[model samples]
Target: MAYGIETRCIHGEDGITREHAYGSMGTPIYQTATFAHPGVGQSTGFDYTRESNPTRSELERIVSSLEKAYDTVACASGMAALSILLELFENGSHFVCSEDLYGGSVRIFSTIGANRGLTFSYVNTADAELVEKAIKKETKALYIETPSNPTMQVTDLRAMKALAEKYGLLLIVDNTFLSPYFQNPIDLGADLVVHSGTKYLGGHNDALAGFLCSASKDLADKIRYIYKTTGGCLSPFESFLLIRGIKTLSVRMERQQENALKIANWLKEQEEIKGVYYVGLPEHPGYEINKSQARGFGGMISFHTDTAETAKRILERVKVISYAESLGGVESLITYPMLQTHGDVPAEIRERLGITDNFLRMSVGIENGDDLIEDLAQALKGE
Candidate 1:
């Protein structure tokens, strides 16, 4: 029987029926550098922790199930996944990427990737024509982040897939914002889906993990080969933590998005707030496109305050919502993109994207909507 995403969250696609020595409620962490050989000219399935581990394999299986991908690789972090992914393309290959992406992605592509001979064109992917215009003979892929980081710009994935098909280019999507419970890019024709499993998949400010899920055997094999060679596979213990965290994925995402929608609505009515960027809001430019593709708008919201001082002061004043970096945990977090996530980007580009000093991005937790609203209310009033 096909399982719903909620069921897939707790029990995975196979339920708890996988054969294990001890029938433990949770998947056990292998926590060993190497696995013992069964006998001469024989092996135990796994030979080395870096190549594969039972715990990490289980983590990959569950994430693959969530993404509806042929397979997935558990990585040390999101950047590691991107780094390994870059290996699939030859040197001097160009990629058409979304402009409003995670600052770290911009940093990696421009610095390390450029240093290694990979070139990138950053465009507003919300406009399919703009993305197409950026493409050329050297372009190998279209890399985009839907409901992009901080600014929440939503790109039409199907349109991008069509562009990829026309150009014979790979379509790579970062599905970190709306976790697999809410969106599966593979189903929409993306060749690969990327996740910073540390955020929603791990669902706590605890473990750090990332994943690359491939839709086809060829892509999966390529990712696996690079993954094993680079040795950036997630540790056994972190894999176990991520598996534990994913078991609660459905509940966490629902509650967080619910809180996010409420918060977005409240932010719009506040005189101290100038703009609110959330895909859930009907007034948002990409609202309909997002609703057509994703099951939910997710927990991230970006709003601009009346002044930069108000933005900074609210970060200091909020009691219920903490001011910090990283997101998709149980605790609500408000971040200053100018200083935090998007700090490395050029000032002119930051201004063009409207990610200014007065802008604030929020990761709504599963906190009570009333409590979160009251906290925002007081923080805005300087009470």
Candidate 2:
């Protein structure tokens, strides 16, 4: 039967039911450490837990199907998946990436490149020309994030795809914020897509997980090799939990997006707020490009107030929204990018990108939009 994402999510990869069997509708977690082999020179799907697991495989298959990719690899964390992908490049090979990305990603790249003599140049990928200009002869990959971190700056995936094709570079997109339901970069020509499943896909702020999806079998195999050898695979239990979380993604995202729109609109009207950045609003710099690609604007929003003092006060006083770093959960979270998500970013770069001390980011939740608005109104009053 043809089904929507919400339906597939609940039933996806959970497996067929045995007739007359009394069982839970949810996918059971297979917590065993290893599986037995059929015989010598024969494999029974899973031989070692480190290499593979039935639970993880089911989650991987479901995610791959959701992303419309040939295959996917689930990892212990998002950074692990990123590490496996970066291993595809030889030492000294260069990568071009978005200047404003998740803080952890930036730190990982900097540390790895410093040790291995690998190179990366960060640029404003929102500007197509700048991205094209940043490509070098040794450039092997183009890494990007849309509705990027604190800035909510949108990148043109189709434009990036064209540049990658012209330069024979692999395009990798971080589709964490929008997830597959809101934006699937593979559909727009990305060779691969990555996610910090700990955020949205897991939904409840529970299990930590990550995934990488690829359309090319050869590319998939390369990633799989690194994944298996590095032993960064997710545990079967976590995989099953993540699968359960993903079943509610569509519903959660819908409510979150709606709440975000309301919050963004309210923030824009505040006198203390300098600017609001969200793709849903037409006045945003990235709105046009974002509209061209995504089905709807996502749940993340960031705004700059007049000063750090006001921002701090607002964060300190916010009632409904928790002061937290992560985004894309059922609970609303507010973070000061300068101190939290993008703290590791160079001050000079952060200033240039407008991720100043005055900036505050919000990941709206499924709660009543009116309640969220009231909470923010009170917080702004205290500020």
Alpha carbon lDDT of each predicted model: 0.92, 0.88
Q: Where does candidate 1 have its weakest 10-residue lDDT segment?
A: 16-25
lDDT of 2 by residue, 234-345 (tens): 9988998898898898899899999899889998889999999889998988888888888888899999999898899889998888999888889899999898888889
Q: List the candidate 1 regions with Cα displacement exceeding 4 Å.
A: none
Which pairs of residues have clashing backbones in candidate 2?
Answer: none
- lDDT string for model 1 (1-383, tens) is 99998887777778853556577777877889998999998998999999999999888888889899999999999999988888888988999999999999999899989988999999999999999999999999999999899799999999999999999999999999999999999999999998898899999999888899999999989888988888999999999899889989999999999999988998899999999999999999999999999999999999999899999889999999999999999999999999999999999999999999899999999989999999999988998
TM-score of each: 0.98, 0.96
C-alpha lDDT (0 to 100) for residue 240 of candidate 1: 85
